[model samples]
Target: MESLIAALTLVVVGYIAGSVKIINEGNEGIVERLGQYRRSLKPGLNFVIPVFDTVLVETTREQVLDTDPQQAITRDNVPLTVDAVMYWKILDVQKAYYGVEDLESALTNLVVTALRGEIGQMDLRETVSGRNKINQALLHQLDEATESWGVKIMRVEVQEIAPSKTMLESLELERAAESKRKAAMSETESMVESIQRISRALQGQPNSQAVLQYLVAQKYVEANLKLSESDNSKIIFMDPKALTETIGELISTDQAELGNGNGNNL
Candidate 1:
């Protein structure tokens, strides 16, 4: 009778130990009885049949997925490299487990495919300027697609968008060329405006011819100085006084023609 009592006590203790389960906070467990899902276990103390029930525990907390940099192309045919991060939470662990074979891998691939698709619809400039727009669009797309997966897409963030090295170099060169063209145009416009002002100031002056000669000589000297500063410049010898006289004669002829036209109009 003593041996039988001892055996019964040991069996009771073993059953109690196996049936009692303590689940920590922020986690959940699914109970499968006889190879079929029976119930879900919540946080804190829970009970399950030890020998027949199997529990799989997973976190309920939010998770982060960092997608690797993926190659993509913009609408303007610019090849670029891009990557993003996604924030998600599992709403239904059963769906998360049974809905997909490999949850993480499926999510990653989905993100990569969506990222490339979004980028392909925008130009490089648009992609760079509208990163926030891109993120929102991705979030919407992912939310809709992940509904059946029992996953909540909290937010999608584009980490980086970088053009290829060759594209970057080409953009730099194009920008530099544009700058030079603009500078040249501005310089030419300023010179033309200055010349018009000078012509107006000298129109009714007595020593207008002398003033014009002096201005022409000054400009000739400045041109020579600029040429001398250039390493590849070839020195060309010319008579400054002769060149100034020729330009002054040309100016006089133009003024005379303008005066005749005005008189005719009057």
Candidate 2:
């Protein structure tokens, strides 16, 4: 009789021990009865139906995951190394537990495919400059894809976008070439504006003959200065006094013609 009573007592204690469950903060536990989901257990102490009920799933926490870098080629035929991060949380524990097998792996592959598809549609320059666009697109695509899995995508961000070494060098060279082209264009505009200003002074301003003579004298000085600085340096034999006299004579003739209304209009 004593042996029978002791066996019953041990069984009772075992039942009590197996039935009690303590879920930590930020955790959830789902109870399964005979391989079927029965009920979900929230944080804190909970009681189950001893040997009949099993803990099926016990997590609903947010998670951060870093995706491995994958190589993708852009529409411009430039290859890129890309990696990203995802912020996710379980919204429905039942669906998260049963809707997918190997949830993390599936999500990772989906992210990579979506990233490659979006990036492949763009050229190298757009892919680099449109990173935010890519981020938004990824978040949108993932949110839709993960809805059935009971996961909510909080955010998706592109962590890195590295191009091949040769591609990077080519991009640098192209940027440098563009810079030089813009600089040349700006200089040409400046030169044109200077010529326009000089033409206006000679055509429409007072003492236009004096302006013309001054411009000719300036050119004479510049030409002689360049000749003096040649690789085979030699003295330029042009007389400054004679040059000045020649300018004076030209100005006098132009002024006399203007006074008689016979000066050239330009």
Candidate 3:
């Protein structure tokens, strides 16, 4: 009789042991009875049915999920290796427990899908420069998609948006070409401004015909220097006879002096 009483007491103690639970702060627990969600347990002491209700899942703290670098393509077909970090937390423990299988994995795929989708809509340059905007947009989209999982996305950070080696080289080449083009444009503008000033200074010269001849001669000298050395460069050939005839019609003595020496080096 004593042995039987001891056995019964042990069974009773075990049952009571399974009936109560204690959840730590910043954490929550999900209770399930016979394979179905019964209730959620908040932090601290909680009571439940001895053997029927089981603590199915416990997760309440904020989670940080670092995404592996995902190979993605931009709208302009530039390939990128992108990675990100996500901040999230469980809002409904019961839903979190039953809503998805492999919660972290599902969330990860969700994040990657969202990331690729957003990146696909942008060019590679925009993805690199507008990282903050991308992060916020990702957070918003994630929050919406994760609601079914009873998860809230607090924030997202784009850790890196690395371009392919080819892309980097291409960008460098583009920058070089752009710089050279700007320099050429600046030189052209300066030349034009110089010509304008020379014309204005000669506006009231003794003979307008001589002044025009001198200006044309100056332009011929300037054009020769500005011509490109490249094999494919174009040259606008002008007839020397036509030019000389035009200058020969000038009768002013100043024009004669210009023809003799003043215009020779110009």
Top candidate on TM-score is 1
After superposition, candidate 2 runs with Cα above 4 Å error: 175-263
- Native RMSD of candidate 2 (Å): 9.1
lDDT of model 2, residue 169 = 98
**Deviating ranges (above 4 Å) for candidate 3:** 180-266
Poorest 10 consecutive residues by lDDT, candidate 3: 246-255
1-266, model 2: which lDDT tens digit per residue? 99999999999999899889999877788889999988888889999998789886546787987999999999989999999999998888888888999899988998999999999999988999999999999999999999999999999999999998888899897997788568747754764455445644465468765665577666656655865775644555558689667656655655455556644553
Candidate 1 — which residues are off by over 4 angstroms?
190-257, 264-266
For 90-180, candidate 3 gives per-residue lDDT tens digits of: 9988778779989999989988999999999999779989999999999999999889888999999999899988888998979977886
Using all chains and alpha carbons, the TM-scores for the candidates as numbered come to 0.76, 0.65, 0.67
Q: Write the residue-wise lDDT of candidate 1 on 127-154 in tens digits.
A: 9999999999999999889889889999
TM-score of 2: 0.65
Query: What is each predicted model's overall lDDT from 0 to 1?
Result: 0.86, 0.81, 0.81
Any residue pairs clashing in model 2, and if so which? none
Check candidate 3 and list the clashing pairs.
Answer: none
